[model samples]
Target: MKRRFFCSTLFFITPLLILACNGPSDPGSNFSSGSVTPPLFAHSVKSLLTLSVIEPADPKRATALGQYLVWLVQIDRNGEPFPVNAISIDGGMPAHGHGLPTQPRVTAQVSEGRYRVEGLKFTMPGRWILNFTVSSKLGNDRFSLEIDVGH
Candidate 1:
């Protein structure tokens, strides 16, 4: 009876003690969290489109604690400027399992293939996944990039 009670206490307290020392994690689950460095320019999963970040309208928006941000990017299909009818943005921290604090979207087509995205607000410093879905004349495709937000 004493051994059974001790075993039960060990099972429950071990996890808490481990977490008290440091948070628990699954190596496979957060594979991209701190290991991989995402590229500034990336190709779609199907390789049908190319997405490139022109620059942050203000460089500080990325590291600014509470400020919203605007971004300019160019989309290309087959290595040329690809105009799109619409672009939708969605993202979150996979480790935290929550979506973005704001619903960011493509505000305008700045020029041929260049687009303006706004309403990006990061609530915390962590590894965030930014996903862009492009809807165009040819077809629909998606671009995903991992962003390491700094404190």
Candidate 2:
């Protein structure tokens, strides 16, 4: 009886003991890497803007909007400031949607590597389709991006 009990107890606890002994370890949990990798340019839509998507800074903390989002639309391959006349969300008309700007064209700043669009805000927690029309030296190029912002 004693031998049988001991064997049963050992069999049941063996896996538990092994799991406790081989517990997972957190390697460099407190370390921080300040720099981030740039987004990969998938391709250009027509001749207007180059489209690219980047992974979130931290996948675990990514929201529906995305981790870090930015749009880079450039005109004149020679790399000069292009005038962005109007921008809108979804496919709404400029006057109705009236996105980014309508008048004195806004030029995106090019620095380090990519062109930057500041304060691109997603209002709600859902999928958002952003459409932009940029008129520059080249012409008018329309670009769109679909982003999901989750709560």
Model 2, global lDDT? 0.45
Poorest 10 consecutive residues of model 1 by lDDT? Answer: 57-66
* TM-score (all chains, Cα) for each model: 0.68, 0.42
Model 1 alpha-carbon drift over 4 Å, by segment: 1-39, 57-65
lDDT against the true structure, each candidate: 0.80, 0.45
RMSD of each: 11.6, 9.2
Tens-place lDDT digits, model 1, residues 56-115: 633344435567887788998888888988888999989999999999988888999999
Rate residue 67 of model 1 by lDDT.
Answer: 70
The residue-level lDDT of candidate 1 at 47 comes to 89
